[model samples]
Target: MKPLVMRIVFWSVLVAALAILAGVVYEQYGRYRAARDFPAPGKMVDIGGGRRIQLDCRGAGSPTVVFEDGLSIDGSLSWAAVQPAVAQRTRACSYSRAGLMWSDASNAPRSAKQVAQDLREALMRAGERGPFVLVGQSLGGLYATTFTRYFGSEVAGLVLVDPSHPDQVARVAAFMTETRSLRSRIAVSLAWTGLLRAAAPSLLPQAPNQTEHDAQAVRAFAPKSMVTQMAEGDATDAVLAEAGAFRDLGSRPLVVLTAMAPYTGSELRGMQITPEQGVQVQAIWEKMHEEMAAWSSRSAHRLLPKAGHDIQFDDPRAVVEAVLSVVEAVRAEGGTPPG
Candidate 1:
């Protein structure tokens, strides 16, 4: 009986190992195929050290507008709804940061300072000359703010959509302890190992009107993308610290879009928290947005009662109008339009 039990256990372990190996192989092949077939829709510009970043630009006008993504979002896809409309009036561009989407992964630290520097270099290489109007969503707000500090003269305006405040981590630490909880860690581990992708691909966010090409791209890079995003999240404090080094924007035209719906605990997936805690989170969030709006003397803090965190998806028109306002303001300030 003992010998038979040992054999059963050994065979079970072997089968499990083989299944995991197969999943890894399948995921790797899918990634390779996606990279070859769906390639970047825009140009790939070398940033240095043989690493390239993907950039997509549209329209023609001066004081070009550059869109930056929130945490984990592909820059190109996130701005799909707003970019076209903005492009109609002025040059609008978006690019994938290193390690996300088609951009080459970098060994550099995933902090805001490094990201800002890479973006500056990519812009110069891509010939998207600025004095740019920088539009940043969520965590991209941190990067945009850092960029202004590093290259103040090149930025003509700023627009933040549900921007992440530097003080956010500390502000909500009590309720957001789950960020470092065991369950969170396990989820990330599964993602890194491709188990999540194999078991439940739909758990990942899908782009609107997702095509077969887009699906392939997501399947191919989801694991790497999650890793990159996690790294960035881990480095949030460092990024916020770097952001503290910048001087306030004296009178730069700025627009801060704040989502009106308060958190109701429903947004936290797979995590349990009280409704009261959720209300507290929402209050802190709104306060942070308000504080960010105060960064510029000419800033406008617009509360979108109907929109959620993803204002671009929920209300593309609002984003377009906010950007248009900034562009018009910049032009009125006598900034030259791109030829």
Candidate 2:
């Protein structure tokens, strides 16, 4: 009976639908444009089964240093500050896991063991020879250890940068493996809708030292990052437990770096961590890194009080020193890295 009102409602719904469709189209176009602007910086090696991994290597030397990135971050981007320095001393490689930027997604689960195999395969196929020095940070630490466990002969040394302990699930049950937050969920939704890429700032305030190209690439590929990060959250508990299965590194020289800074208000906000809980978590984290240092008889536990969790970004010197130190130890052990 209310034809006029019904017509208005119908038109409103049509207009809204049209607007959303237009935004979606625009977002796709933007992603294509960004990819063109910042293409893959390294070689995309096929790891069989129609899937490929991005492996970017630099410098020239032996005992190749391979970097494993922390949760959700682009592998190479995380090492922007540290890798170049390490590369100057020896060969350095950074790679993206499946579903991450430039790497083809896989149907396989994102477990530590799986990631290790994927890496080994990629390196082997790409002819990136080993007697490799593995450097891992945060979640990457687990994958690095697992890789060594499965392929010990090739791994000559290890440098763990604020690495996550395998037992962290029990130590900090509240937030150890739970990475999904209210903010992340919101970001994921926005990313899929293309709103995130659209709303991204012209400059990345997070990493001021980054180049303009890097900043633009971050904004463009952020949507893919959000989804991959969420998938990784699902595998955290499994990777932790799996990596914990190996405890001893025998005589392999190990260096465990721990950042002593407590969680800031901003960081705590992102993790939804309370101030009191942050203190407890911090204490537990330090102890975990200490225990990891004992994995090798020749291990050193270096504590950087001024640095935060992302020590590479905050203190590139510390990371560079640790990695180069491990490389020196490996050379002292008399292992020649095959190229």
Candidate 3:
């Protein structure tokens, strides 16, 4: 029995050492590979010294529609289903924020306010003649509103897909502070390390129809695997950023899309969120809708019955319609949406 116990302990130490060595090598290789093959947002102009912000211009006409992706590594591909349909009637585009796929990692700042400013500069540099109808998903919603407020005159209308809510941030923070889960903490650490690694890679422009490609680009920079803690940290930070952006918005024509379903992806399931949590999130969204309703007289809310946080991917047609309506409203007002 004593000999067996000792052997077990020796093997455990060996496994631990192997893990550490593997992690160090992977990190070094990842950083090096990322720097060499970082996706570039081609023909996309940089603003504020980072290529993370990119513009993909398509079609032409009136009330140009601009789409901004949510947090994580999302890009214009999130609008894959919606942009083309909208482009048929008016000028439309979807952009990758800095540190996201096809966009250069940013070193300046990651605040919503800073991101909005970058969008402003990108538009000017790209020569995108706007009365842009700004559309955003999740954290992108925060940036969209910030842009509208800073460049109020340039904005024609707004569409927010599962837009981040400030109150939601408080709730998330409270939960994280109270929860003492080791799994959650480890997950967060892994996620941050991956994000940091992506920071070193250069940004590039991608194909308009290359949704899968875009996903692959962003995935390449993520850690070998995800853990629960990493997800919690990411979610918490997102909510906090949304809260900050919410405080700065002004009255604007806006349409917000809220999700009705809980996400059931492999990642989400791995996190062990239960059906009860789904119901709770729906309830939270209801309250969030009420809070957002007070933002403007024209502000309205829509429910995406099938989607979770990533509403666009779940139901692109609905997002397109909501965005188109905003574009029309801006055009009707004889104004261009903010680019």
Indicate which candidate wins on lDDT.
2
Candidate 3 per-residue lDDT, tens place, 1-339, comes to 999999999999999878767766767787567546754443567575435456777788877788887765546667776888898989987877665555566556356666778777887888886777888887677777777767777777788888876666566442223244575455446543444344323332343344655545555544422332133235556545554554433455778888887556652455455566656656876777667756766778887777767767777888888887877777776773333
**Model 1 error, position 68 (Å):** 1.0
lDDT of 1 by residue, 197-299 (tens): 6644566556544455555666566666766777777887787777767637668899999887655355754335676777678788889888888888888
Q: For model 3, give the 10-residue run with minimal summed lDDT.
A: 224-233
What CA RMSD would candidate 2 show? 2.6
**Comparison by TM-score, 1 against 3, better one:** 1
lDDT-wise, the better of 2 and 3 is 2
- lDDT score at residue 202, model 3, on the 0-100 scale: 37
lDDT-based ranking: 2, 1, 3
Kindly report the root-mean-square deviation of model 3 from the true structure over all alpha carbons. Answer: 6.7
lDDT by residue (tens digit), candidate 2, 33-149: 867887887799999999999899999889999999888546577788888989999999998888777788889867888899999999999899989999999989878889989
Best by TM-score: 2
TM-score of each: 0.89, 0.93, 0.72
Minimal lDDT window, size 10, model 1: 262-271
lDDT, candidates in the order shown: 0.80, 0.83, 0.66
- TM-score sort, best first: 2, 1, 3
For candidate 2, the 10 contiguous residues with the lowest summed lDDT are 202-211
